[model samples]
Target: MKPALFYLIFFGILSGLLGCKKDHVENVPPGQDWTYDPTPFEIKAPASFPILNIPVGNPTTVEGVKLGRMLYYDPVLHSDSLRACASCHSQERSFTSDPPVLPHVNLAWNTSFLWNGKVEGALEDIMLFEVKEFFKTDLEKLQNHQDYPKLFYEAFGARTITHELCAKALSQFQRTLISGKSKYDRVLEGTNWVFLTDEELNGFDIFFTEKGDCFHCHGGILFTDNSFHNNALDASPEPARSAITSNPADVGKFKSPTLRNIELTGPYMHDGRYETLEEVVDFYSEGLKTSETVDPLMKSLHLGGKHLTTQEKSDLIAFLKSLTDTAFIADTALASPFH
Candidate 1:
């Protein structure tokens, strides 16, 4: 063939091959793409906080956190439609309700979850329990919903929502609930121009010293060691950690919840036995009920407790209140999307 004619035929074949690629795009339904890549969301935490161990398979994304926040507040997750994760965990109360419900703040650092440590491991592990065992979420409702299908698709690259995906999404949001802006944290940073009162300072001393004996389990950046302990709440308390461990020594042991928002997360302790911070102080001061499972850290059990004086009790309570991070409880991002 002549040079011009040969060139035309070769170019025509190349054009035809390109046309085939366009056919696949044409075959796809409107607005539907085969590839799904959500935007990565970086979690912000304080300098003193430990590095988060996010699951490789379930990284936090902007879309995932948004979906998770909605799921967290929506009552639709429950079969009765009368309760939501937010029902027991309210933001105003530092994501906690009356006792047995712990605050959600700084959960990213926790290895054990729940009052009794029934679930342990990553945040996703506890979230799975929340989705499957706690909520018993019906996938059919989510699949049929007008918003969830699209939300799931954008968040997880899947239109079919499953319990596992639900758990992962919830975990993403929970991981972002960092609470490190309290007065105590400000004092630690030494840059926020915030200082504790004389009473709070005295209480801090008591808390860190053997006088209060609180630091043994409640110390750390997160204000909790994330371990189970039988704090001598009762001589014969109900089975707690034992239920999960099946060990007699574990009985009456409960997880040490974060005190980041201790002022707001009241009805204190595993059973909500104490109504006020004063009562909680009084119990540790002189009312400890010793038992076989009492934590060794409760060294003052022989003396009937810490025997904190009336002024000391007041000061200790003042210090715990210093941990209330107003910024965390009022963050609009963590609040209910519906609200």
Candidate 2:
């Protein structure tokens, strides 16, 4: 061959390779941008609750949140293909199951997932460790199949699921699960779609008053202290905080949950004992079972015997209903992606 022709052919191939590289670079999606819209509703956090501290490494991003949402609703993470995180933490009930009905008798409707509020860690931790363990599958199988390892690389800059990346993605997705725009929120925002009846207003007053004493633990936009407390619900004299910390006094304590959608997220309390809010109120009013580690806050209120007038009880329920955010429940963004 002529030297000039051979040189031209080599250079042509090199140019083609360079052009292909450029196209590949162009086609790749950019890293996620972390900013999210925070204006729809002011979180209205109570003075007692601190600003929720999110981790620094996994900044909130649209892409990361989307990926987390996909993972959240995907049952692929489960071993037998039976459960997704959503199976227990259902979106319809504020990311909690209403109540599981077993064979012979109906189980009390408690909040979802692990019994002891042990799943309070980052969502990624729950998904990777807790969930994967539940399925009892091998780690390699999880990493190799389903393109999950590739997804981890894309969402987070890692090829494998590190605890930090998983937590970041899960937390980012959770932060997006905001439950604003309830009837109570509307009333707070001065909307006229529905007016609070006088009785409900009275119930609201009672809820905030010393007589009810409910506000101490359940005050704030999220309606939780965000601190662990022992409500003395356990049958055995077990120390709650001991599990999280070996401190003797810490036993029997559990984290308080948000009351945003309380009516739907029943039967009430840590153990799911109360079927009705009325039962819950009555317990607080009178059923203060004494225990060595009982919360100092749980003093006899002389409430149940006095009896909330039927109208007052109804009003209190109405106020609780006001906490339910219908818009959140039906949000397409949070729905199961598999469907």
Where is the poorest 10-residue window by lDDT in model 2? 101-110
- Which lDDT values do the candidates have, in the order given? 0.88, 0.61
Candidate 2, residues 213-247, lDDT tens digits: the string is: 56777775667655666765643656555675677
Q: What tens digits encode model 1's per-residue C-alpha lDDT throughout 1-339?
A: 899999999999988988976886688643354346799999999989998888899989999999999999998898777899999999999998975497888888888898888888899999999989888999999888878888888899885789999999999999988889988888989965689999999999999999897998998788889999988889897799899889999989999988888888888888798888898899999999988999999999877799998999999989999998999988999999994
Off by over 4 Å in 1: 1-35
Task: Quickly count the clashes in candidate 2.
Answer: 8
lDDT of 2 at 283: 63
| Regions of model 2 farther than 4 Å from truth | 1-52, 98-139, 146-150, 232-238, 301-307
For candidate 1, report its TM-score. Answer: 0.90
Best by TM-score: 1
TM-score computed on alpha carbons, candidate 2:
0.74
Question: Alpha-carbon error at 333 in model 1, in Å?
Answer: 0.5
